[model samples]
Target: MFEKLKDLKTYEAGKPIELVVREFGIEPKDIIKLASNENPYGPPPKAIEKVKNLASEMHRYPDDSFFELKEGLSSKFNISASNIIIGAGSDQILEFAVHAISPKKVLMAGITFAMYEIYSKQVGAQILKTESVTHNLEEFYEIYKEQKPEIIFLCVPNNPLGECVDAKEVFDFIEKIDENTLVVVDGAYQEFAAHKDKNKEIKPEDILKYKNVLYTGTFSKAYGLGGMRVGYGIANEYIIENLHKLRPPFNITTLSLAAAIEALKDEEFVKNSIIKNFEEMEKYVSFAKENNLKYIDSYTNFIVLYIKNSTQIAENLLKKGIIVRNMASYGFEALRITIGTPEQNDKLLNTLKGMIS
Candidate 1:
């Protein structure tokens, strides 16, 4: 057994509704869970129906090919279905990328997704992180040239901070990297980020034009399918073919496949969710400004607030049946809040204001 396996820090997920209810004695209905950035509006209505309709199929094995899911994604992204690689979630794709590239050294922004580091260490890769609240392209260029890590993971609208590097900047960076280097853009929050600037939105099609670049996104956030765990990676057919050799057969459930098919059909739901999220995000920014709290301007569904005593605030919010992410795990005290419905947002705003004041 690998010696470091004993010390491996398992990924920590946001607190769920039931967990909070059990711990705080809060009623399920009263608990407002904005910690995970799941769409409160729920999956497209058609997807819910699709899941229920396929419930009886649990006795049957999932379709190993995932034909319909790939078709759905291909239609949405306007790419050949042959180029899509489905995984349990974007997380699984990240793992596959690390193992596939077999990088001696991995490079990433210091404060991007935590899983990149965890997976890198799990495979015993030397990881190099360029320190920044947001990615410093100049710093990244220097490190990329010096280290020449085989895999570089870039998460657009980065998780904790909800900030992003411009598409042009990222593309320009990728162009400079050695062709041997695999550049994986984790766009799990792309839908929300797209709302910030339509003209400057990160397009998988645009990014995948580069042979070395692959884009991974999820149905978890805007599609309200986190529980279903459907995510995909888009690249050239060559990368998809090579990745399939490592992909687990029948990895996604039948219900998730059915639901994702329907979810993609209902583009209106995704559009509405983005619209609502933008409205709520603006409210969060305004409230933070009004309270004089320092916050990272978010292009994604979540916002990061710099709070010295973040854990204390989280404890107070949890007591009120409101849950948030505390950034102590990231070594800086801050709070990352997911945008919820207006009433839920109001509750959080009021509670946070009370505590901060």
Candidate 2:
């Protein structure tokens, strides 16, 4: 019943606030968690209100079709309902994409998101990862030409490193890839990337014209619904149909769906979140420069610092009731620090300065 399951590796999630409390004997309120890249603010106040109002309805299963959430997504993205598929999170959609494509071979950036590899393995696909922290489009193109893999997962504003690929470059890559190859553009950080753009904005819809591209997004980050696990994917109707075939019925809970629908109506919350993010990001970048420490310029909520003793730096902060991701699993000696509120950011900078200097 469980053949090949032993070879699979467990995902190492960021330590929870409660876990840190247990480990370090710290109060939750005093701890600043810039670890999981969760929205520092949290779900829109209206969404919380909506959840509270719906608390009595938990006995009912979520609407099997997810009509309300899909409708909200359709109005927001200007996509047809047929093209969207809801999942517990983008991670679930990643698994659905692998199953839908049923790939014999898969290709992804070596240092992008970790789940791509884990999900790819579940489907028993031959996985080829790139040899760089940031994906080289030229290298990806060459690899596509040589291996002709059946599926590819590209994380925009790639996790850990926080570097993003331009949409034009991605579309060009899509044009050159074999039509049979399915390309999943993981856009969990797409909102932050859009705010950073100068002359042009790259919408997820821009790539939808390509029959081969499936763009996945999540409300977990900016919408502050990480605990709710609300994420959706946009692709051609046929692609989504195949995913629906494999997707279990009523996968999302009733309350989470309601929260997401309400969150969509609160665009101002997301707008304010973006505004705060960039301002805080500037503080982080300036701190890195002032200290003469190298950090990857980020297009997303978090930035990666190249500290010499990353683990020690993180430990020092942990002692001071701060938690940041020590990114050793992605094979980098770095700490991926999420930009938090002004005070939180300042605390992080001061703590790091004390530890490193």
Candidate 3:
């Protein structure tokens, strides 16, 4: 009987348009996917043009060291290349961080990025999950006193919940965690977070002082490079060197590296994307208010709303060709809606209003 595979919960990715259309007998062209927190503005024009030109390089292998890309990122972030390691995505670096350290213990607040818990189980590591949508430094310290796991995963502007623990709170928690433990701060949405008034940017140089904290960031979200899959980790040289052992040579492709290098130069593109996101968020909030739907304020590109029979609502919305994430599995009875172009957002709002009634 194939020995009952390691008991794993299947990941519920936001329903794809094809799947929804087939399941509901709807037209594919009518679907507007706003479930995933993707950049609606799309990739920077320069990056797209560069990716097209670099297509011929597919015949050759990528530089094993990811030299030019790393140099570009390091210069932009004001960190040395020695302190960085490029990966297929930040999630890959997340796995590498855990693999580099042992004896395989994981700690994180509840309701963080679902992948953190999933990846912990894959490695057969012990997981110490705190039971709170948000982490309080005092409560985290109490938990640390009890288990003191070897590694901690902290997602800023955390997924599902979309809340960020203030920098001072994070610093305090770091001071309280066991000195030997490594804290991995996954800032997958950091570029979106640049405008927040309360949270501070976790710079690469700052890691020198907090040697135990390793920060992972991705180009996937803000740069609209999700398909390219290029990301990086910034940490102390020692930790980075140790993690490199677990990284495969040529893990990131040449095309991705090239696109990332060009994207880094287009700061204006990122700035414009952020401005659009903020504007759309305001409209989303106003729509939610007009409809009387309760939503949490979010710094990221997505807004989460609490609703009754959320799965049914999500399904109904899907039938009308608007795909939003169903949070029923998260035990929250909520749906996370990603901010999109003005017209797309308006369509989603109109569809959702109809579904709710």
Clashes of 2: 0
Q: Kindly give the number of clashing pairs for every candidate.
A: 0, 0, 0
Which residue ranges in model 3 land beyond 4 Å of their true spot?
Answer: 1-5, 21-29
User: What TM-score should be assigned to candidate 3?
Assistant: 0.95
lDDT of 2 by residue, 185-223 (tens): 888998888888732245766767777888999989989
Go through the candidates in order and give each one's C-alpha lDDT. 0.87, 0.86, 0.81
In candidate 1, how many Å is residue 276 off?
0.6
What lDDT tens digits, residue by residue, belong to model 1 across residues 145-221? 99989898888878878888788888888889887999988899888777777644788778667889889999999
Q: Which pairs, if any, clash in model 1? A: none
Predict model 2's lDDT versus the native: 0.86
Ranking by TM-score: 1, 2, 3
Candidate 3 shows a clash count of: 0
Residue 192's lDDT in candidate 3: 74
What's the lDDT of the predicted structure labeled candidate 1?
Answer: 0.87
**Tens digits of lDDT, candidate 3, 1-357:** 523326756667777888977788778767788988888888889999988998988888888887788888888888889999888989899888876775467888877787777777776777787777675557666777787778888887687777776766677778776669898888898777757644646665666577788999989888889878988999888889999999988898888888888888899998888889889889878877887888887878899988889989987887778889988887878889998889999898877777776
